[model samples]
Target: MRKIVTVADDADLAHLVDLIDMLPGPDTRSFWGEGSNSIGSKVGHRLREILSGRGDSSDVDYLAIYVLKYLGRGNRHIPEDRITANLRGASGLPAAGHAWVEDATRTAFTLVTRYSLPVWNGAHRTRGSAWLQG
Candidate 1:
């Protein structure tokens, strides 16, 4: 496999190079290009790698493919959430007006009640537990 280089500006790149130079091994890396969608999970993982101080961009190609697949996942080019809100409401899920609106309202209420007693504490804690279980 070819080497990889992080995409960064002068100051960040200088620091990166210096850090790499200090590592026990001598290595070089290359970059094919920018972020893409074909590699969504891979890109996410690489992002975690970068954030955690690992140096690798083999995921760039996968990212490019991922971006090409879902060009608007990063941007609301089609205002999909608005459209989804309508569709979800129409789905007849017994929502408070609709699923989207219901979720929005519920989420809003949750925030609004941030100053309230811990009555919702169990529910919120359950949500966290579910996340961990998942």
Candidate 2:
């Protein structure tokens, strides 16, 4: 997963929740807890509860990463990316190969970039932090 600087406000977070709600949750039985039965839908709902005039910036930042991990599964239904899997665990084979997954990924990325700060890549530091300078 790419490092992101989350600048999402309540409205942006609300929109993101809407997008997330459209996805089907993971199909694994163990993923469900005592009260919650759906992973994807529960994530969105929980985010909504937090963002509904109650959450702080830290909550938003945390949830932004949470939503990204939830959206980052590959065509194989798992994160495929080692770092992502290590951090968020394998995403099981439920939403894999779905066209909506691509749409959700793009929307999530667009939301993130809309307010993200420019990151200075370590390997490219020789060029100086021109983006920050600007």
Candidate 3:
């Protein structure tokens, strides 16, 4: 039997993109096709387009697939609250140059690994669920 997974809400999707925005250097270029100088602005623009229903679904799915392929779980489940708390904690820290970036990257990695992966995997298995509708 297939399990149905609800699509992540807009706020959640934004947070996921924010996490991606925090990625450093090569990872940023590799995933987002841009440098870290103004990745946030570019991603923000894409997010706005997406929220407005003017973005490409394939673009969104590409990010989702990347997270699922890299961070998916086998049978273990990680709570979203934990991921949120970690992200919050990471953001709360004082700006320490590259250290903060590293912290954010680590937190983002964990969030994708523990939270986003399952959602993506579930949706993929079902060929998408009702929550996927924009």
Best by lDDT: 2
Native-structure RMSD, model 3: 12.2
2 or 3, greater by TM-score: 2
Model 2 scores a C-alpha lDDT of 0.47
Cα lDDT of model 1 overall?
Answer: 0.34
- As for candidate 3, its clashing pairs are none
Residue-level lDDT tens digits of model 3 in 80-120: 23233333345534443234334444544554444445666
**Any runs in candidate 2 off by more than 4 Å, and if so which?**
1-11, 24-49, 73-97, 114-134
Say which candidate scores most in TM-score: 2
- Candidate 2 structure quality by residue, lDDT tens digits, 74-111: 63323334223232323533343243455556655655
Residue-level lDDT for 93 in candidate 1:
31
lDDT of 1 by residue, 12-74 (tens): 333433322222221111111234422334435544554454544433333333322322233
